[model samples]
Target: MSTKDVMIWRSNRAGTHYVADTVVMEEPLEIRIRFQDSDGKWVERPLSITMRTPGDDQALAVGFMFTEGMLLKNQLDKVTIGLENTVTVHFKPDVRPELEKLQRNFYATSSCGVCGKSSLDSLGYTYETLHLAENLSPLSPELIGSLPQKLTEYQSIFDETGGIHAAGLFDWEGNLILSAEDVGRHNAVDKIAGKALMQQSLPFNQHILMLSGRACFELLHKALALNIPVVVAVGAPSSLAIETAERFGQTLIGFARDGRFNVYSGIHRVDALVLPKK
Candidate 1:
């Protein structure tokens, strides 16, 4: 395994230098894809490579393809990871997408991506009519507030590296159902989604998704694919993520800290209970 220990310097009133030991971040690995064309020809294409935790590389690639409109569930044949930081995704021979212009860059940092929308109009262009259950109930405040501490208990990997982002799944009662941590927030969510898919427990609507980072379009897309109706994040939701949630009728909660949160869209699912005038 490739790992490193790094030191940091923090300037405070107490001191100007602080030796904080942390795991070194693995640089982004390039993900190249190859598939058979319609004319019985094999074509190799270079896809977007990202800075990831390296644990769930296959799922991360699949999720990336799914979100970027380059892949459909049934069209994929298999994903193979080779030696020395390389992944190849193969598709069925007859599978063809209308990707006329493959627009991308070399590197995708944790904070951004190449293909995802940067504007409302771009978001609308990529938005798919999500499938969701309409009559879902709201999570109680008690249930909602207890998530962070519960999440803390399941973070074994984070305990080891302190260099990962986590995504946790919880039931209506705030029980820590499942959790995963990765260097990339999206990768963690994709791992959760891919596991659910493999178990045939997908369309993850009945549970709440809590992210360690701010909500983004890719996260919303993953939730939508699983038919997840409730998504909570410890950070904020971007404008695109908010729009996606509103378009799909999924509840979007962000700034989830210290028992208080903001609902950007689909607030009805939260079931706001107002007090009577005393």
Candidate 2:
């Protein structure tokens, strides 16, 4: 990663300003993918490109695959991403389960799926519901109150650009466990998931996952896939995310700011004496 110099400006209370020097962060290089359905055979077709920060492209690819429901964990043979704008994910043969669902209109985009799926109902998937450990205690108000500050403390890139989204994991005791930042909020979640998967600390049912933005259906889908018992967001949640959370018995919190928050579902996880208004 090389550094580039840029001009900066600063002003004081007296409306006095100065031109200074600064180093700007580089954009992430996006690796766009395309698929070719040659007769009955599916081939990897390279289509387009974009510029990104150039790290964790593999995780981004995997996350994209999972979100699109094109490849599950057991269905993938391997995912090999190259240094350049190329990524190849090999799937096991004779697994054309949803070939029709794989429409030709599937075009990869640089933005994460805020409008991910066609219908809200399509976002809901039957997930394995995990019971929390009996020994695991509920999250206290004090712990919840300090989360935003702690998340900001760990956000290196956000402090640098204020243009990135973040996702962080914390223990029941509110200890800052792990954090990841990306231009896309979903990518941030995927990076955190990829890191936890690499460390073999998944099935984070006892832990809390927090997002820097509003809770969307895609985030809920990923949380259900990971079997995370609780998800908190700094902003409001989508109606579909709330529905999925309730259906899966996962706790959902939103509008968490300035020492107040709202719990959308599974209120049992938070140990406050008074619950939020519906």
Backbone clash count, each prediction separately: 2, 8
lDDT of 2 by residue, 1-278 (tens): 32234556667787856664433234544433333344557665432233334456566655555545655565555557766556665556645535544443334333445354666466555543345443567777677877887898887766656666788898887887888777667777776665565455666777888898999888877776666788999989989889878887788999888888899998777787874799
Could you estimate the TM-score for every candidate?
Answer: 0.80, 0.75
- Best candidate per TM-score, number? 1
**Candidate 1 structure quality by residue, lDDT tens digits, 94-180:** 776544523454567765543345654554332355556666667777677677778878776677677678898887667766677
Show model 1 residue runs off by greater than 4 Å: 6-20, 101-106, 114-116, 124-128, 171-178, 197-200, 275-278
Global lDDT of model 1: 0.72
Candidate 1 TM-score to native: 0.80
Report lDDT per candidate: 0.72, 0.67
